[model samples]
Target chain A: MTKLLEANNLGKRFGQQTAVSDINIHLSRGEVLGFLGPNGAGKSTTMKMLSGNLAPTNGQILINGVDLLEQPKQAKAHIGYLPETPPLYRELTVREFLVFCGRLNLLAGKPLRIAVDRVIERCGLGDVQHRLIGQLSKGFQQRVGIAQAIVHHPAVVILDEPTSGLDPIQIRDIRHLIREVANEHSVILSTHILPEVQMLCDRVQIIAHGQLLFSDSIDALSKQMHASSLQVQLANAPSVSELSAIAGVVSVQTIADSTFRLHYQPDNDPTERLVSLAVANGWQLRQLVAEQHSLEDVFMKIVQREENSKDA
Target chain B: MLNLARNELYRLFLSPLAWVILALSQALLAYLFLSHLDYFMQIQSQIAAIPGAPGVTEMIVAPLLGNAAIVLLLISPLITMRLLAEERRNESLPLLTSAPLTAAGVVMGKFLGSFAFLLILLFMVLLMPLSLLLGSHIDLMQLASGALGLLLLIASFMAIGLFLSSLTRQPAIAAVATFSLLFFLWIVDWAGQSGHDDAGWLGWLSLLKHFEPMLQGELYTADVAYYLIVTLTFLLFAIRKLDNERLTG
Candidate 1:
């Protein structure tokens, strides 16, 4: 796949305070890279640098193989950015605003009109196209923001908190629009919503305290959410030592008078041996299930681990 | 650059503020023009006996245009206040900054947009004098010179407003600061009349001092250059301010 956006050693500092530092990120054509971070985690700062809205104190950004610092005009031509506030002109009608944005990105004549029409159609802005942006509902305004970002079909689209103030239905609509946009352009979505990343991203990067702490594929992250323990309930009580001695059982904990929680390696088999042992020893098995871990648990674990390491 | 300018003009016209400014200024200046003409008609025969005396262009058109300049001085800040400051306040400046444009392009586009609107106002004011050509002989050359001076003066005002707008995100503050700065420069030459030292340089620094000569049909290259230099200098300041914002903001 062609790399549409690339940043190396990207860092930004405002006076004595560092906003972000030593960050490296890249996106390929048609890829949605979710940028996850807590509030004040420098996500907006990084997005601004990548989109060329702000110059980095120490770094280089390349868009479509062009150096952003050396040739900002050409480099920015390939970038479409929707800042956190949406960057809208509320006085103009939706169609007029989109046309203006199209022209700002260098689209002209018939192409400008066509791009405006296409975005209005895609973003479900057709009904409100002639209405003033200020009069529209929040959802329609958000659609307009997304429409402007992709009006010229740039190679890389950077959206910062696109669904921040939206209601649930609007969030779903915007997410759907983003997914459709990902089919044509590489998207870097900066958001703190974990499920949003899980639903839309091919790869996810987590940033905290202005540093990139975790970066990997969604599948790898899902693996971290895999269950590593088994919850078992036997009608007839059994000794803790007897449950721990089962093949592949690493540890055992008594949850109730007759229940035990078994901790085991994912690759090992312990359920079959425990069941057979229960049958032979007259320990009646009542309930047995794996304890699943949610994505939030993994996120909290990662963030907490990073904090602890920093403190150490 | 042209696209940004067109967008600015489009948004400007969409709001009621531009229309209100246009109608009110034209109505006020038209009243001033007709009154000046009324006064000129009464004094026409009295001045006819005098040789090489002033004509209708001197008596009616010059003062009307002079009043028009003052009207523009008061309203130009309002026209220019939203150019950059409102964009910053509304957080829409990222739309321009993230586009494939330089800081100079953004500033010049805004300047041209507001300047074009002021030119329309100037043209309408000139039309009042042009209307007198049907009834009597008016000095077209003198009228043209005054219009040129007004043109340069309008440009200088716009550039100053734009530079000041770039310094703050509050459009109201931008308007107030622009008016205060322009008013000071307009009357800076008055200090020389009050028996101040270095009167020559103070007169040279006054915007109205440079503008007054051309209003009286005296078109000097130095006066033209002074307006041009002021326009260009403020434009450069606005561009530099935007570039600096990208670095430090």
Candidate 2:
């Protein structure tokens, strides 16, 4: 549970426009932290700063307790970054590029070759190891990109839109590969794909409009925005005020004539109490159930709240 | 650093563009000699006709090498235009910049790779002097000096090209800028001399003039220093530009 990376008050600006502002993020070892954001939301910018490709306009980045700007070589030693496009050379064969990458990471002799072989095998690039990179499919090329990034055996692997421009099967395969890799290295994957974060990432940080809205585990995020709801289907229509007056019932909304919904406070399981009250009132509770919160619902609610705040 | 340069050199060797430029330049240099063979033979015959006359090779050898240096200048921008420019265009500079290698290493490695290819082109043309001319007065030291001068000259311009390539992602733009800057330096030296007494030291800017004396057998420290400084300046410029890009972009 040690902190692997930290950025304090990190910011970036292009002339008059600020790409990122007042952002602070920290990651721990073996944590697959998903960076969820829309296009132009500064996900890529923040990642570039962390990976040593772009410097922050202001603030500090520490990798394994080392200041990035002060000791860049050491700071970058623990990071394996695959930019949005993978930064691959189209000319070199897969093995050659990886060998060069291993050397760039200062690996040589046995360890270098071992590292290259491990990553190439791990990335499933063994089939095309001798093929020119430009000749590979988009998925294969991305795999090579991932291979080169992790060839140095860094502590953290940062991928920007790793699943972008991929078919569903390829996306699933890559996501599975990411999960496998996450067992060893802390993963920071920047993606707008909701399912990618939900399925592969352990925690998610939602960024929008150059500001971080929230960062938490998927379960915690759902609990925050998803108010517990009591889904009751009555044989006949129930008065809104009647349902609202029920104990543990904070409010009532009508989804349909016979189906009424109840929003209640957190930690209060109102389904039993509501059923008791319905029995007392002789209301026909044909369907009485507890609603489960989904990640999609949570994401939409959080996004809506931000939009509301912007309007306010 | 070596790995990066090795990768760059591999790409240079594999690129069809490099071979196209090589073959094309070889033909041009050979033809430059072939078309003027009669004129050069006439001068050699004149020197031969006179007893104990200075050999034509001694007088025109440096100029011919300088002419080949000019060929280097012309074809180099084409070779170097893609070094950093295309990398930036394809968003590959970050791959190199983010690695453990420093900015200086990247620029120097690329410059050396481009210079290596230029040296190959110059070496390929050595047969021209060997097969065509029957002179027994070939000074091995002078030939080495001429090749060294051409290498130094090519290195200086390659540095300039490397710096210019870092300036833009558009290969055409970088190539044009390199040509314009080198062309200005080529004519600027003569123009500086034509300006009479007022324009002092402006003539030193010309790479041609500094390399001129070294084109002959004798090595001048000043010329070596001049080329080295220009090489160092442009290389430092490229490194600084790369560092700035990393910091701000």
Per model, the share of native interface contacts recovered reads: 0.88, 0.68
Q: List the residue pairs that clash in candidate 1.
A: none
DockQ of each: 0.71, 0.58
Model 2 off-target regions past 4 Å?
Answer: A225-312, B34-45, B49-52, B130-135, B193-195
TM-scores, all models, native as reference: 0.90, 0.86
RMSD of each: 4.0, 4.4
Per-residue lDDT tens digits for candidate 1, residues A1-312, read 778888999999999999999999989888999998888899999999999988999988999999999999999999999999988998999998998899888999999999899988988888999999999888888889989999998999999999999999999999999999999989999998878998999999988879998889988877776877899999986889988888788999888898889999889969889888889999999999988665557767887888899899
TM-score of chain B of each: 0.98, 0.91
lDDT of candidate 2 over B1-249, digit per residue (tens): 777777787888787988898888888877776655556666876667788765545554655687788888788789889999999898888788788777888888898788777878888876676554574555667767888888788888899999999999999999999998988887777767886885656788787777777766779888888888988999999999999998778
Which stretches of candidate 1 lie above 4 Å from their native place?
A: A226-300, A303-312
Which DockQ-derived CAPRI band holds candidate 2? medium
Residue-pair clashes, model 2:
0
Q: What tens-digit string does per-residue lDDT give for candidate 1 at B74-192?
A: 99999989999999999999999999999999999999989988888888888889999999888899889999999999999999999999999999999999999999998988887
